[model samples]
Target: MTTQQGTALTHALAEVPGPLPTSGVIHVATPHTSRFTIVGNHLAQHAELSLTAIGLGTHIQSLPTGSRIGIKSLAARFPEGETRIATALRELEAHGYLHRTRVRLANGRITTRTVFRNQPGPTGAPHPEPPTPTSAPAPAPAPAPAAAPAPAPAPTSAPVPAPAPTPGPAPTPPATRGSVPVPAPEPAPVPSASRPAPVPQTHPPAPAPSCPARKGPARLLPQPRELTAELRQTASMLLADLRRHAPELVLSEADIERLTPATATWLERDARPETIRQALTTDLPQPVKYPAKFVRHRLTVLLPPPLPGTEELPPDRPTLVIPMQNCEGCERGYRSRVPGHCRGCRAQLSAA
Candidate 1:
């Protein structure tokens, strides 16, 4: 090839869109025109989040509104299982990417509402600007001093002298009497003209009413009745011993703890330990993928009702009339309502 032609061909190759040359993973970019989710790098590349959490969050964001993302649902859809899915949800919540709140509806049903955020708030994400420091309010400007009244203008002329008292006042002075001296009245205070009037107190608007937190649904298994230390220990032992009956039925500590209460419920219902063992060990699936779930299912489905009390027994019962007695004549056992003789003695006497 000619040098100019080779150069032109190299330029064309460079212009063609292709995966960028890189040592590690390469990316072939494609624009998503119809359906796509835009995730911020802050969340996609979060330093604290694990790979499972990041992926789970991305999947949740892509789903449409009103989608079910519960632990069980997610577990069913993906192979991560319920436990890992639950942990990932918690991680997302801690990082402020998800929020779950239980709210009571007008119909009095309690349900959980979940909210997802693309960008976390101050609680989890870094704040761009430091909080403006709260400064003390500038002291209210001192009330302007009241202006002093202008000195009364000096009289244009000298004040007139008082007239002399009348000379004929001495008719008869009244006799002096003992009396208490009254205190002089104080002068009224002068109001300041520049001082502002007092402002009436205004109460802050009452906070919006909040709904009380209502309890969630009842547990899948019934609780043990009259729970006591002995009952709890017995249930725990029964669960721990199940592995001996069926080697494949081994349960973990968590499983044992969870099933203990249900087992205790069985004992409370008057079920014998042997009977419970038979119920659990008789039906053996070739492989028990989740031992705890299997055990829980059995416990719930096979739970017996409580035994009736003595008062509940029927009042009418069959009575036996014939009572066993020893014959006086021969000392032989006979059946009669009262003391009597054997048939042989009665026949011999009659013959005479």
Candidate 2:
């Protein structure tokens, strides 16, 4: 709106005839012609969403396609920290204003895909707009009330006397410099013996005790074996090369030297160098404060159990022994699994 028009409108409102309200809001709306988003009132006045979530939703809707809305990126752009921003994003996601999914690409790389909806309607339908109010046609003007009969003609010589004004309630007089104000009477005090005893306040009963949470079995470091030169060198190389996989895991020579023995323990248990590296590097925590300490903790806690040797395995149960039996056709002592003829007797029978 133009400045002159706004000023005129304000003056017009001020000149209104009736008494103005003592409280409540008055809106002076202006049309937007550029750089504006069409956010629906459903989102703007959502009952469940917090102010931060609604605002974040609107901001996301206003941004052009391909703009980064990741927590870190948004945290950098706005004053809100990553935790609050993450919470706002979660709220948006829970309320269907935002959707996020982890997608795996053809090249075996994983990435997050986010979608922001301006109006999250069920069944993918657009939210209906509020109907505009239509003004009713003004009623036909009512016939003017008939004028009262002209007052009885008064004598030309006598002037008609004016009617007396109706009286109203008298207004209170303001306090004067010489006036002495009346003081309110004080409440009478009761004797201590006559006063009732004060009742003691009671509190609600305490809640029942909850069971303690179960914890996972503790991880204890395995017994160490003699560290061979080959094992030590391999462990040191693995520890030093960790930075190649995760730059945050960079360690000094002394740190690597101190942690080599722990890593060597994994190697002594027949754990491969690749496995050891993967355990150390995969899923590294954000902002690794002390890389050396983190590596040591992982090396000790995630140590693989030593493989069992052949002699260490329990032996199988002994096989059952078969009983001997005499051959029926041999007429001589012979052994067989069943009562069958010996080879000589069978051959003689065949020849006959």
Among these predictions, the greatest lDDT belongs to 1
Expressed as tens digits, the lDDT of each residue in 249-351 for candidate 1 is 8898988888888999999888999999999988778788877888888998888888898899888788878988787778888888888777776676688
For residues 215-287, what per-residue lDDT tens digits would candidate 2 score against the true structure? 7775554445888888888888999899999999989999988888888889888898899889999888899
| Candidate 2 clashing pairs, residues 3+ apart or interchain | none
| C-alpha lDDT (0 to 100) for residue 250 of candidate 1 | 89
TM match of model 1 to true structure? 0.40
RMSD (Cα, Å) for all candidates, in order, is: 25.2, 21.3
CA lDDT, candidate 1, residue 40: 68
lDDT of 2 at 157: 14
TM-score, prediction 2: 0.38
Top TM-score: which candidate number?
A: 1
Poorly placed runs, candidate 1 (over 4 Å)? 1-27, 127-352
TM-score for each predicted model, relative to the true structure: 0.40, 0.38
32 in model 1: Cα distance from truth in Å?
2.4
Worst 10 residues of 1 by lDDT: 175-184
